[model samples]
Target: MKSIKFNRELCDFCGTCVGVCPHDAIELLESDLRITDKCTLCMNCVYICPVRALEELDEG
Candidate 1:
């Protein structure tokens, strides 16, 4: 399955990835972001992150 990975060092918690996710899979917590099982791996979050903090991961 494909999923989203967060780079905390690069993330500013702007919530752009959460806002852009079509599946409502991304969440912006007080301290970090969360990826739920609802994620469809659409890559919308990955593309929308201005800081490039979100990454796509392949788990085969």
Candidate 2:
């Protein structure tokens, strides 16, 4: 299965991913980005992430 992966080291806490999530599956913490279970595998956050912090994880 393909899912979203968040890299805390790469994330700048910019909240850009949060805004782009159609399902509101992304959360911006003080230092972390959270991908919620509300995610429908849309991959919108993956494509819109400017810093490449979010990516498509092929867990197959």
Candidate 3:
């Protein structure tokens, strides 16, 4: 399966990823962004993150 990897150190909570996600799979909480099961590995979040904080990961 494909998943997302978050680099908390690089994230700025800019909400770009959350806005770009078509599946509405990304959410921003008080302190962090969360990826839910609805995610389709669409790479929208990965590409939209300004800080490159989100990455696509392959998990077989």
Count the clashes in each prediction.
Answer: 0, 0, 0
Predicted candidate 1 versus true structure: per-residue lDDT over 22-55, tens digit per residue? 8888778888888999988889888988999989
* Deviating ranges (above 4 Å) for candidate 2: none
Reference-based lDDT, residue 38, model 2: 94
Looking at model 1, the pairs that clash are: none
Displacement of the residue 11 alpha carbon in candidate 2, Å: 0.7
Count residue pairs with overlapping backbones in model 1.
0
lDDT of the candidates, in the order given:
0.86, 0.84, 0.88
Worst 10 residues of 3 by lDDT: 25-34
Between 2 and 3, whose TM-score is larger?
2
- Assess the local accuracy of residue 2 in candidate 3 as a C-alpha lDDT between 0 and 100: 76
Q: Which ten residues in a row have the lowest lDDT in candidate 2?
A: 12-21
lDDT of model 1, residue 2: 73
lDDT of 1 at 3: 73
lDDT tens readout by residue for model 3, 1-60: 778899888998888888888889988986788899998888988998999999888889
Candidate with the greatest lDDT versus the true structure:
3
lDDT of 1 at 48: 88
Question: Could you estimate the TM-score for every candidate?
Answer: 0.87, 0.90, 0.89
Pairs that collide, model 2 = none
